[model samples]
Target: MESQESHRIVVTLAQKARDGADAQQLADFIVSSWQTIEASLSPIIGQRSVATLYKRSFYLASREHPWLMDMHEGMQTTVNLAALKAALLERTSAEIAAGAGAALQMFYEALTNLIGASLTERLMRSVWADLFPVPTQENSA
Candidate 1:
């Protein structure tokens, strides 16, 4: 169960990183992941185990997957996999909890890994093809 959950999280994070075509997809992804964790974990830890859940989840996911990138992710993801893992090891539940803004950071980190240098540029670009201008030779000049 743990292994499977971790795999799903990594996949979800990767998809989110890609800034996929639909915003709802990322919402659904996060919601489903939460549902699974809550269902399997709430019975044992009650309501207060959210942080514990993340800690345990990270531990399980990262143990065998120290490599960071999912199969769908590319070489851009591997650049700082080791460093990120090391940094993640030192994080506290306070710093890295889902509720404490860590989860958002996780998505952002995964996005950075997935896209490398294009992350910032992509953020500045509009998603709609019509809204986004295609630079022409005149514009380049």
Candidate 2:
């Protein structure tokens, strides 16, 4: 079992990892760290709900725009986990910010590919659309 603080740090690092690190590196980190996040949230949310929330968040985050699309383009890149862990430990906010967008794109791509497009699309549509409500035909018509 992982500590909550460690999980939070991992989540933050995973978010940063998406900024500029290699897609595979970020993907691997997400995969490993997911257990921590899941564990941390499990008691509060229940396993199924926590899993669903994670899927939704990842889907929505990944599909926000073209950067993520580009990230998906290189989804097969293998991550050097040691290097990634080091980068997460040492990388600055500016550096992270610079590559974070692209990393997130890649993360989304990897996730969508692993999880399937339909599920990813449904998660994105349900979670993100609620936050940033797309105008419906009723509104336009």
- Please list the C-alpha lDDT of all candidates, in the order they appear: 0.36, 0.42
What TM-score, computed on C-alpha atoms, does each candidate reach? Answer: 0.30, 0.33
- Top-scoring candidate (lDDT): 2
Lowest lDDT block of 10, candidate 1? 71-80
Cα-based RMSD of the predictions, in order? 16.9, 13.5
RMSD of 2: 13.5
lDDT of candidate 2 over 1-141, digit per residue (tens): 232222233345444444466544544544454444445445654665554444343335445432322322322223233443444444444343334433433434544665666664554443333322343454323
Compared with the true structure, the alpha-carbon lDDT of candidate 1 equals: 0.36
Candidate 1 lDDT, 88-112, residue by residue in tens: 3443322222221234234333434
Query: Candidate 1: lDDT of 59?
Result: 41
In Å, residue 105's CA in model 1 sits off its true spot by 10
